[model samples]
Target: MIGILAAAALQADAPVEWTALQQDNIQVAELAYDVGIALAVICRDDQLMVAITGLPDPAPGAKFRKLEVNIPGAELQASTWRIQGKATISLAPAVYARRLRTADHLTVRAPAEEGEPARRYELALPSDHLALDQTLEACDVPLVLETDLTYDPTISAVTWATSPRITPPNRLPPGGYAEVVLECTVGARGRPENCRAIREQPANSGFARSALLSIRTGRLGLIDGGPPPVGGVFRTRLTINVVN
Candidate 1:
């Protein structure tokens, strides 16, 4: 019984032979060999993740070892590295949650060393351009964000029209001036329809009315999807010219 127990202890402390991994965008910084091998990685915390290239054997299943990552250029302060699955076994690649936006951004805050201010840097992560659960065939798959946008419209022509009416002032002093507001409906077709004076001036309102009639009438453009403009109001200032 004593011999059997001693042999079991040695078996438990044996190291499993493995090959060095060549993952794109990831570099293996250090490796420690003990009862089991431990790997240290230097990679971007945002978007950069890890994955197991080779699978375990068909029989019992390959065991997941523990993995560690060191963020260089950071002050050695009291900090803890968080790992998913809460398992000490070899660390797996960092899993990212699905985000429905233009791009993903992460800001890491590390204690500033002696002179450098508390260092804070932003990292832009690759977006999941493909749909969820999309299988990737390539060993090195590049994740990209898909953006669908519409183009802007170009103006073919533009024209402005003015009214031909005089506005009356409230307290028409010797030669005071005032402006009246004219309400017109400009449709998407670019035609000025229902042209009329919604507001009135004091006595010389006729002059203001004539000024509004000077505007030209025409179709602006094809209104296939655009809604026609309704109840549009425009302000026009008219000088009061009373006949002598």
Candidate 2:
């Protein structure tokens, strides 16, 4: 992790300017740049974040209040905040890793108010896969492995606020059993977000939906000690076994 932190620090100091837009286009948005580590490593807490500096504050009641980001294999939305004269978007670590690994370009669209036109900006990705790999490894970051996640007692102890109710779908035959797996990020506050099904035994079963709902609404207990949970990957497995 120290190596990753160092690399990220270097990147932060001299980020590559990826793209810039005219003031008229984005209401003072200047440029989108890349710091070597796609996800910003918060050295103080070892949390992962993605920040895009240089955007104007949004108007009240804007249609696209959140920023829309798209890469080759993923489409993500992030909430923005005005800090130090720039608009910034924070991305989940898991999401950032998934998209940045193979993405060649990043496209971002800003939300517009009732009468304002939406602005779009695109950024080219750096072509250093080896460095990126090392960076990810140094951070001990896991690849987006949906079905292969092992249970982490520390994460589970704090995150498992309530037991998820897994109901066997009516579509299943007698004595049927299925396994559902989900991948999610637990923030510093221990709240889960970006929950999605990594694997479901039976296609079209409601198990995945139920699991997602439970994760989102469940309360997370506070975690103490090393690194804030921000962007920490959490996976849960639910096996529904029907009785005769």
Candidate 3:
């Protein structure tokens, strides 16, 4: 009983931050509640997060879990990573933000595992969407929160002047296939910068690591029609299929 009161007091005293704030080169916009839950967008990494404070550690060898996320009319499944008590989702950041922008509340359901009963949490969100907007803006992702994304970025006219070497992982199965989607920024001289994997197949396979290496040396070639505006988002998938 006393502990519950203490938690409530802590919640009341905590400062409210609804805008994207920078700390140590990483920018984030988040909404936290007294229930020990927070919805966050980590801009530098281009990932969404559901942070639950004081959550217990997972059993050994657990890599990920499917979390059910609920907004107005959609019930989405999130592949969540348990990191320091937070459920981090590393899929399409822009799409996630767009769906969340107009939501009045967010609900997360954690399915029961290993005999533990399932758990559910519902949280209210602000009507104003300044923070969410900032996240998309910071990454130069298109503004589609108000409407469906109709704009497809043009990379066709652009060529790779200095491109990274996409190679198959050394330990990959002889006849296996792997792919990774990278979110990168078009830096000076059309080179890709700050690239990170947003999706990967066969988790723990070295595909994601290799893909990053491939982008490390990639540079775009363009003229009148070109890659996304310098600093705009550039997403590309790297694939390796080794057939015997």
Each candidate: RMSD to true structure? 27.3, 13.2, 15.9
lDDT of 1 by residue, 38-110 (tens): 2222233223333211111111221222111222212221222222231122121222211211334423343
**Candidate closest to the true structure, highest lDDT:** 3
lDDT (Cα, tens digit) per residue for candidate 2, span 123-207: 6665554444433454456655653233221222232554454555657734577767777787645667898888777766777
lDDT of each: 0.31, 0.48, 0.59
Off by over 4 Å in 2: 1-44, 59-65, 72-87, 129-135, 143-244
Minimum summed lDDT over a 10-residue window in model 1 is located at 147-156
TM-scores for the candidates? 0.21, 0.42, 0.48
Order the candidates by lDDT, highest first — what do you get? 3, 2, 1
**Backbone clashes in model 2:** 0
Model 1 per-residue lDDT at 147: 15
